[model samples]
Target: MSRIQCPRCQRPQSHCLCPLIPCLDSRTRVLLLQHPSEVNHALNTARLAALGLNNAELIVGEVFEDLPRLLNQPGYRARLLFPADDAQPIQTYGASDEPLLLVVPDGTWRKARKILHLNPLLAALPRVTLADGGVSRYRLRKAPGPGALSTVEAIVQALQVLEAPVSFEPLLRPFEALIEGQIAAMGEETFRRNHAGK
Candidate 1:
C-alpha cells in the first residue's frame, strides 16, 4: 500500500503540515534553490516556508540552468543570502523602492557549498548576511557552528530585518508547533532527559 500525500504541503496525508502553515504575503520575494537531496527530507522546512508565503517559489536541482533569466527578471533585484566575509548586512528596505529577490540555497552545508560553487550567477550576485539572529529554534538538526541557523530560521530573521517583525511572525508559527509535536512524541521523560541541563 502507498502512503497518500497532501498535494499542497507534499507530506504524507497523516503527517500533512498544511493546516499548521499560515498564509502570508511578503514584500521580499523568496526563491529557494534547493538541492535535489533535500526535497524528500522528513524535516524539510523550505517547503513549509514556501507554502506559508504568498510570494515564495521553490525550485529543486543541483545546477540551475535558468539562473540567468531568473536573475534578470524585472521588478526585483536579485540577492544571494549567503554569509560571505564581504557580504553586506540586510536592510529593512525602508528607503528602497525595488523589491527584494532573496535567493536562498537550501541543503546541508556541503550541498549548499556545491550549489554556490557550481552556480556562477549565484556567486556573482550581491551577498547579504544576518548579523545578530539569536539561536536557532530548530532543535532537530545540529548546526555546524554557533549562531548557525536552519534555513527557515535564517529566512525568518531575514524577513524580520527586510520587512517588519510582524510580517514574518506567521511564517514561524507552525515551526514552533512542529517542534512541540516532536517533543510530545518523545514524551515528558525523554524530552526532560534531552533538555535536562539546557
Candidate 2:
C-alpha cells in the first residue's frame, strides 16, 4: 500500500516538509504558473515556494483561462521571470518604484515554453531574469544548462535580488531537506556513481 501522505506537502507522513516551510513576507508577490505534469514529481519545488512565502500563489494547468485576473493585482507590475536576450536582470527596488508581481513558469524547459505559447498574456509580460552564475541545488536531474535552477531556487534567487537586505534563505530549508531525503533513499553509492560529480 502507498504510504499515507501529508495533504499539504504531499510527502509521506513520515517525511512531511510542513515544519520546515517558512511563512515569510515579501515586498514582491510571486505567482507560480506550473505545468500540470510537474505536480506529481518527487521534488515539487514549486509547491515548496508557494508554501514558504506569504505573497505567493501556485496555479497548475496547461492554459490558464483566468490570466487577466491573476495578473491584475493592484500596486504591482507583472513580469515574467524567464530568460531572453532582452530580458532585464532583476534588481533591488527603491521606495518609489512599484513592486513586482513575479510570474514564474515552473516545469521542464519545453513544458514551460508550452505554457507560454498557450497563454498569450503571460508571454507578453516584460521579462526579467536572474543573473548568470546562479547554480542549481537539485541533484537528481541533470540541469539542461548552466545557471539552471529549480523553481524554488529561482524564486529565492529572484526574491534575494528584488528584495535585497532581506534574507530569503529560510525559504530553502524544506528544499534542502527534500534533496537529502532523495539522496538517502537512492543510496550513497548510487548517488555518487550517477549524480555526485555533476
Question: For this target, which candidate reaches the highest lDDT against the unseen true structure?
Answer: 2
- Provide the RMSD of all predictions against the true structure, rounded to 1 decimal: 1.9, 0.6
Q: Candidate 2: misplaced stretches above 4 Å?
A: none
Q: What overall lDDT goes with each candidate model?
A: 0.84, 0.95
Error of 2 at 33 (Å): 0.6
Residue range 1-198, candidate 1, lDDT tens digits: 989988887777877777779888888899999999999887678888898888999999989999998787689999999888889999878665797899999999899999999998898999999976368887755667777887888898899888865568777877777777777778978977776435
Judged by whole-model lDDT over C-alpha atoms, candidate 1 comes out at 0.84
Score candidate 1 by TM-score against the native: 0.91
Candidate 2 lDDT over 32-118, as tens digits, reads: 999999999999999999999999999999999999999999999999999988899999998798999999999999999999999
TM-score of 2: 0.99
Candidate 2 local accuracy as lDDT?
A: 0.95
lDDT of 2 at 166: 94
Q: Which runs of model 1 end up more than 4 angstroms from their true locations? A: 191-198
User: Local error of candidate 1 at 195, Å?
Assistant: 6.2
